[model samples]
Target chain A: MSRQASFGAGLWGGALALLLTGCQAGLRPIAALNQPLSGLGDSQSPSLNSNWLALISSRPGSRAQVQLIDRLRHAPVPLPGLNRPDSLPISVAVDQRGERLALVRQRDDRSELVIHRRSLQASQVVPIEPAGVPQRVSLSADGRVLAVEVSRGGLWQVDLLELP
Target chain B: MACTAVTALGLSGCSLWPLRRQPAAPAGLAAESRQQPALSGDGRLLASLVDRGGRTTVLLQERRTGRVLPLRQLRNRQPHSSPSLSWNGRYLALLVQQGGRRQAVIEDRATGQQHPLFLPADQEPQQLSLAPDGQSIALELITGGSRRLQVFSLAAMLEPDRAPGLLESGGGPPLQP
Candidate 1:
């Protein structure tokens, strides 16, 4: 009887240890994409779906570029005239369908909300209020409602910009 | 009698362990200094930023059960700035500063999948919103002098095997003429 009690206690203790470890593991990413983006002063901002990844990177002393990489094809899509050497990308949002792309670009103190339709091969720039500089941006799935965070005189405000 | 006393003592000790008492969203979180309450579409869950005891944490709580989800990833930050739940309450998007860059991340509750969304440099995400269809997310970034809005599509990210529908079929207006 004493031996059985000892075995049972050991089993319970081991089960407790395993349970604690599992809880401590927390959430983890299934896969982290490896890209050849480097040599920048800041970290890269990348948004990925299961297949495509849109990453923003700036070369040494050059303007930032938003590059789209196809995960299955393992190739980068060539976007001619998309990279503006004179302006910097502030933020980028891709739609669920990977059909639309929205980003904020800044030239000096001025900023504009740029929407790119991948399928149509066209883009648009919406003018923003000149009172403050545009910072972060998000677009709705249908590409109808746009939200921009603007800072004026040291205060942050959210601006909802509707696309026509 | 001695064995019974020892067993009771051991159980009591385990129950009193500090690790066993999980950290939760304290009361009065909505009244904190800077609170952003994001309620789910069905109004079943609410995700909010709470400043408790000089520290800021993002909490997701079930309205009826009063049970909070244990989001350990958000706890690593000194202050988890902004948290927004999706319309379906399946995904959560928030901002955190990791590796010296402020980026947004989306977490799936059921699968515990945490993926970081991309943003530009020096532009910290100030606010986050998931679209009603859960196919896109909106972020408001605050840079040095300007602020901008960005929308990321979840359809491609979520459904990689499917082909994207053409825009000319009358989905949305073209940005350029």
Candidate 2:
């Protein structure tokens, strides 16, 4: 009957594009992780690799997602396009051997910096360097120096002495 | 009838292609006063930066007789802001860090007084620009190994012998500091 309905519509359009690119790595990372050295809300910040985690969310509709937790196959993909489309993810940097990844985008007076290639499927868009209000995003201990500081402004014209 | 008008225009183009929802945090502002509002430079004043759980704040309002100023470095954590305003809003510029040190504050909310610009000890200034009757300020420093582009004078830190054209040629020797 018409080749079995075109092979079931090509296997349901390749299983809905692999279920929308396998929905942001569902969640699984716990090799003794405890991260909590301050910071709790307002759409979060402070996540360096493991246990330096800090993620805040304002919720209101929400838009920002990046999942990369393969602590040896615990699996949790989705890191492509590195969370664009309103890209309000603010922070995530784990370079210096943990493979490579740096992502941040802060609104209200601008701030954008991206660097990808952690692999959860990549096709492009992995450019870096464009500081603009970044405070503490260091990567050197043999990762080739990259530090930023714009800590946060408006309370006495501070830019944290202009770090490098 | 022309094939039922092309099957009702292909099911109305599939219900006019998805996403089209709006009507949020309006009708009298308060999803925390509609988030980002900053309206200084002669609009009378309005600023924003709020965070609930991680506790962040900065709201110098008065956009037409409403009066509100709870901007003491936005109390209780969650800083990392840059809420500026000083073309006639009286004065306000920020950068308040924690932990690895960082300080550069300025708030004059018509004589509320606040001024400090001190940074040196592993510089980490990731951009800041303000110049327009606000007394000059522009920085993008990153100390150690030259990555500077500074220009400031809120009556301080402008002494490259008092503005040697705001010092230039600050480069070389930094492949990654």
fnat, candidate 1? 0.01
How would you encode candidate 2's per-residue C-alpha lDDT over B104-164 as one tens digit per residue?
5666655665555555558665544333235444444556643433444443312111111
Highest TM-score scorer? 1
What TM-score would candidate 1 get against the native? 0.49
lDDT of 1 by residue, B1-177 (tens): 533543343322111111111112344432233244444533355565555567777777764454777886666764676566554467777777677766677777756777666544676776666643345554556667444434455654431212234342335776675
Please state how well chain A of candidate 2 matches the true chain A, as a TM-score: 0.26
Runs off by more than 4 Å, candidate 2? A1-164, B1-69, B73-124, B127-141, B145-177
Clashes of each: 30, 31
Q: Candidate 1: misplaced stretches above 4 Å? A: A1-32, A35-43, A162-164, B1-78, B82-87, B93-177
DockQ for all models? 0.02, 0.01
Q: What is the lDDT for B95 in model 2? A: 62
Specify the CAPRI tier of model 1. incorrect
